[model samples]
Target: MSFIGIDLGTSSLKAILVDGQQRVVADTARALTVHRPQPLWSEQEPGDWVAAALGALHDLRDAAPSAFRLCRGIGLSGQMHGAVLLDEADRPLRPCILWNDGRASAECAALEAAEPASRAITGNIAMPGFTAPKLLWVRRHEPALFRRIRKVLLPKAYLHLVLTGEAIEEMSDASGTLWLDVGSRDWSQRMLAATGLDRSQMPALVEGSQPAGRMRADLARELGFDSPPLFAGGAGDNAAGAVGLGAVAAGASFLSLGTSGVLWRTTAGFEPRADRAVHAFCHALPGLWHQMSVHLSAAASLNWWANVTGHTEAELLAALGETVTAPSPVLFTPYLSGERTPHNDPQMRGGFARLGHETGRNAMTQAVLEGVAFAFRDGKAALESAGGPIMEAVVIGGGARSGLWLSILASVLDMRLHRYPQTETGAAFGAARLARLACTGENSGEICTQPLGSPEIFNPQRDLVAAYRERYDDWQSAAEFSRALQ
Candidate 1:
């Protein structure tokens, strides 16, 4: 049998087809764009996600028809914290409020004020990026629309609804909404009340490795599947990426360089450090939890620079050669969309300092890479303070393709980074593994084992590490600039 995994990402929908042995048969992706209707507000039409996801699957089917026909299971993973409100007719009331949207800051504070034990309940601080706060923002500003809401689904859960005709959510993704008792791996009643929502609006919850529902018969027929595919309760993008990297055991970790930068570490138990802005959420698997230090921008910063400079990310990165001889002459802080992790200040914008006349494209590009690496250093320290240090990390995401970025990351954070094949599609691959687990009831450890081949490892260089030690200090000072940018 073959399994399919789909990851609904902010900028794309990625899918992979794998055989029973878990070897990738085919992979495809469809580009997606985020719409910014107003400053600090990011939104996407709900219909676009369904279209892109189906399109990606169609691409996979066309690429390998024989392999696609044998598909028995599917797993879903997606960007977390999106608020998708559905009307009574099961249609989206408006465009989804995206994970990176910061327009709900005031609502974040208000939610905290209303629920004093919110941190204790959700194991997370009330952030504007969370779903509950977005609802609060809508309730206050768009009361008429809020009143018509019939269901609240995360992006992946909305997809689950469309595929199965049932609204179901899994633990890992639900934890990000500030509506789950992360320690218990279930929805928290108090949190729902605080957000002016109730159980009826929430979807049924499941573990990420369990079956949520089967694909609708029509969807199955449309995709050429002989039977309705079992939909695994996949995961949030970060958790699915962890599963893909085999970062399920305690202290296992990965640093993701996607649209947002994330430092993820699995914990043996629930560990909450909301005081430090460290995210403590449930793992996709039961009896496990994870912590993350997230920055709103990582690869997105490079993408932005590439867009403004009229160069593809590949071309811009190629100009820098294999590695930098020294830290960039100028310093940059990768806080383009404000920041998270150690600094909860969403108003702390990023910028460059100490640029000289010699600062050209290569120099600026090196700084951008180093700056993101330095930001990871901040995340490293925060996670350590919350628990212990993450000695090494599997580097995954689009940025993992860049040898220079990995070199700089290793030197800046002084941790080894492992780069495996298919580094960019780790989440979708992991979702496939989850589908396998859900269908065959296999031992997770065996199913989610680390890649077999010897991975190319990026180790820290003595001289570069020393140089970065000082540069990181300089980066920190600049990162603390102000809230005035808001």
Candidate 2:
């Protein structure tokens, strides 16, 4: 039987169709707009997510109707930290306040100061992206709307509600909301009191693979299939994406270079970073915890370069490929959307240093690649500080498609880089596997038995690693210098 996984991302929505043996049959995606109505605001129409998913499903059906018809289950993985409020009829109250939105700065700060109480309950320090801060922002500035909140769901859970008519969150997504008791995998009464949020407004919590509910027969037939069981409690995108990368064990790790970037390491137990720079979320794999260091601009910087140069995504990588040189002296700080991990400052900006007349777009492109890697190292330091061992990082994302970018990231990270055949489809593929287990009652880990295609490994060159060390030190100093600008 076929199973499908849908990834509700910030910039786009993607779907992956995979069969029993774990081979991806078809993958589809659709782009959506990110609205910025005011400064420091990022919003997206929650309906756009459903529209994108349906559009991709239509495309998938057209591509492989028979396989789509045979699909037995559907799972969702979505961008975490987005607050999507629903009115009494289960309609969105307003556009979702995305993870990148910085309007909750004050709330985050106050919560951070109360870390002892906050962490004692929520299991992590407050950040601007967590749901409670955004809810507080609404309560203070948009009280009328906050008063109308009948339900609050993360990005993917919102989509799941639309698809299955059941609105509930899984532990993985719940962990990101700062309302979940991470240690016990339940809602925190302390957090509810602090945020003044009615715990009833939240959905019934379930584990990631737990059955949310079956798909509506009418909706399923309308879309092209018999009603299949739908798993509600899917996962936060990063955690689900880690499942896609097979980073299930404590030592397994992966570097995802999507529109944004992340360095994720898996552990069988929760190890919250001491500084809380790295996010500590429940893994899609039950009984495991995942720590992630996310960068706001990974390939987004390269994408901007591609736009300016009028090069297609393929051409941009091609140009970087032909002009292979030892890592360029130019440095890039990919803070286009401000940074998340290591440096939690949202006021930071992106830049290129040591740009001489000879420094062409290729060098600039390489800088963007290496610069993201440098930023990732900051999170690496945080995770290491928490006593997690750094191992070779499996690389996944659109940026990983760039051979030069992958090699440079490996060198800068001073680790081996392993690329999967379906890099871009990691989340969907992982979601598919999860869905299959939920549907067929199959062993989930069996999906990992087959190694992901022929992975190209990039080992760091000693001299380049030494040079990157010096460059990294300078990068950190530059970030400190820029902090005063805020």
Candidate 3:
């Protein structure tokens, strides 16, 4: 039997066909647009996600009819931390506030300042991207909309409602909402009270791989399926990506470089840090916990540089090759969208310090790559301090495509970076693996035989490692200085 996996992303929806053996037979994708009406505000229509998702699946049906026929279940993986509010009739009240939207910063600040109520209930201090802060923003600014809210769903849960006629969130997605007790895997009553939202407003929580329900007969037939089993609680993209990297087990770490960069580590027990630099969330894999430190700009910063410099990534890479020989003693902070880990400051700006006349474009590029690497290393150190010893990290995502960046990461972290066996579509393929596990209770076997590629290991040059160590110390000091100024 084959399982259908749908990956709902920020800019697109991707659908893949995978057999019970966990091999992808065919894959297709469709794009969706996000609108930014004002500065620091981003929104996406929920209908666009559904439309794109359906179109992608329809394309999949045309390309792989036999695989479609053999499909036994449909699983969903999507963007996390988005706030999608629906009216009494399940109609979207407005475009969703995306995970990257920072309009809720003031609200998050106020919530964080509450001290007693904030830490006691949410198990976290509020951050701009969290759903609760977004809700509060709407309440303060658009009271009418807040009053109309009957359901609060994340992006994936919105799609699940369309497919299965149920409004619910999986443990993985719910963990991002601040309303959840991450340790207990349930809604926090204290948090709900603090947010002035009722328990009824929240979706019922379920395990990640459990059957949500069968696809509604009409919707199933429209998409060329005969009531496919819809796996309700597939997981957020991060959780799915973790599964893709096989970080489901203990002591495993996965470094993701998408539009944003993330460092994910898995542990056996509930481990919440008081610093609130990294977010601790429920893992897709059963009985596991994940802590992630996010850099708002990872590959995005590279893309920005490429666009501004009018060069392709390959061209930028060639330039870097010319510059790595003479490492510039300059620090570049990768804060294109502010920062998340170690310093959750939105006002912190990206810059190069102590630049000399010798700093060419290539040196600047090298600084950007090294800066991101250093940022990740900071997170790794914090995780080690909180959770203890994390050495091996499987590298995956668009950034993993660059050998130079991988080497930089390995050298900066002073740890081996295992290249993903399958990288680009790790999240979708991981969702397929989850479906397989849900269908048949087996952990070891081929999930996808078509390996993306083997990782090219980079041993840190002793000189570069020592240079980075000193640079990292300065970077932390600089960040602290920036925070004090703010």
Candidate 4:
């Protein structure tokens, strides 16, 4: 048997076909566009995701027809905290307000003012990126549209609705909505009410490993499937990526250096630490939870630097290799997109400090790399301060491909970092695994605990640890000054 996993990412939609042996048979990705009509605002039409997903699946079917024919289940994973509002006819009310959008900052403050217990119940500070704040923003600014809303869904759950005709959400994605009672693994009526919503407007909740619904008969037929595939309630991207890395058990953790950086640790039970800005949310699996320290920018910082320097990422990295161990006199703060973990400041901006005539291209590049690593270090410290300990971390994402960056991250965080062969297929692979569990009736622990291939380990350099610590201090001071300016 075979299963398909679809990842609805910010910039693209990726589909992976995995056989029973857990081997990837065919993978396809389709690029997506994000619209920013105003500063600090990000929006995307939900229909574009549906189109990209369909095109990706079509490509997958062409690449591996046999596996496609044998597909027994479909699983989904996607970006979290996006608000996709729908009218009574199931038509989208407007463009989805994305997770990185900072336009809801005022609404976030209003939420906190109206519901003081929000942080205690949601286990998170009110941030513009979360779903609840976006809803409140709509209620205030788009009152007519808000009144027309009858249902709400996260990005992937919206896709699920398009696929199965059911508006259902899984735990991990719902937890970010601020409407979930994370400790109880269900929707919080009080929290929903604070945002002028009710349970009826929310999608039905399910665990990520369970079946949300089966594939629509018409869609299955149109896609040339021999049988309808079971649709699993897949996870938010981070949680799904964790399952992909086999980090389901307590104390298992990984660091993701995607557009946003995240340091995630799994736990056996709910543990809320909102004081430190550590995100406490349910895992994809039932009765399991995880803590995440999120930085709004990671690989994105490198991308921006490359763009401004008029060099490709490859060119920049090649230059970085020559000055890998050189300490940069310049310090960079990577809050170009604002920050999340350790400081919930939406007005924060990033820049380089202490630049001089002697500073070369390599130093500036190194500074950017070091800046991102230091941000991860800040996240690590926040996670630890919030009572989540870490002995090691599995590092995955676009940035993990760079040996220099990984080395710098290891030294800066002072933790051993492991890299898996399947790092590139992170969240989609995990969703495929969840599909397998749903289709075969296997226990989540059994299916998700299988070892990832032998990992390459990056150990902290003994000599550079102290130097990186000093650099981190400088970075922290720079971050503080930037926030103060805001």
RMSD in angstroms, candidate 3?
A: 2.6
Q: Candidate 2 residues 42-154, lDDT tens each?
A: 89999899899889999889888888898888888888889999999999999999988878988887655644577656656677777888988898899999889889999
Q: What is the TM-score of each candidate against the true structure?
A: 0.99, 0.95, 0.92, 0.98
Candidate 1 per-residue lDDT over residues 1-486, each given as its tens digit = 999999999999999999988788999988888999888889998899999989988998998998898788999999999999999989999999999998899999999899999999998888889999999999999999999999999999998899899999999999999999999888999999999999999999999999888999998899887789899999999999999989999999999999999999999999999988999999999899999999999999999889989999999999988978899888888877778888887667778888887779888888899888888888888899988777898989999999889999998999999999888889998999999999999899989988656789999998999999988888777776644545
Which candidate achieves the best lDDT against the true structure?
Answer: 1
For TM-score, candidate 1 versus 3, the one ahead is: 1
TM-score of 4: 0.98
Q: Write the per-residue lDDT of candidate 3 for residues 358-393, one digit (tens) a residue.
A: 767877788778878888887787777777776667
Better of 2 and 3 by lDDT: 2
- What would the TM-score be for candidate 1 when compared with the true structure? 0.99
| Worst 10-residue lDDT window, candidate 4 | 319-328
Which is the winner by TM-score between candidate 2 and candidate 3?
A: 2
Off by over 4 Å in 1: 482-486
What is the C-alpha local distance difference test score of candidate 3? 0.78
Instruction: Give the higher-TM-score candidate: 2 or 4.
Output: 4
Report how far residue 329 has shifted in candidate 2, in Å: 2.9
Lowest summed lDDT window (length 10), candidate 1: 477-486
- Residue pairs whose backbone atoms clash in candidate 2: none
Clashing pairs in 1: none
Model 2: weakest 10-residue lDDT segment is 442-451
User: In candidate 3, which residue pairs get closer than 3 Å at backbone N, Cα or C atoms, i.e. clash?
Assistant: 22-447
The global Cα lDDT (0 to 1) of model 4 is 0.90
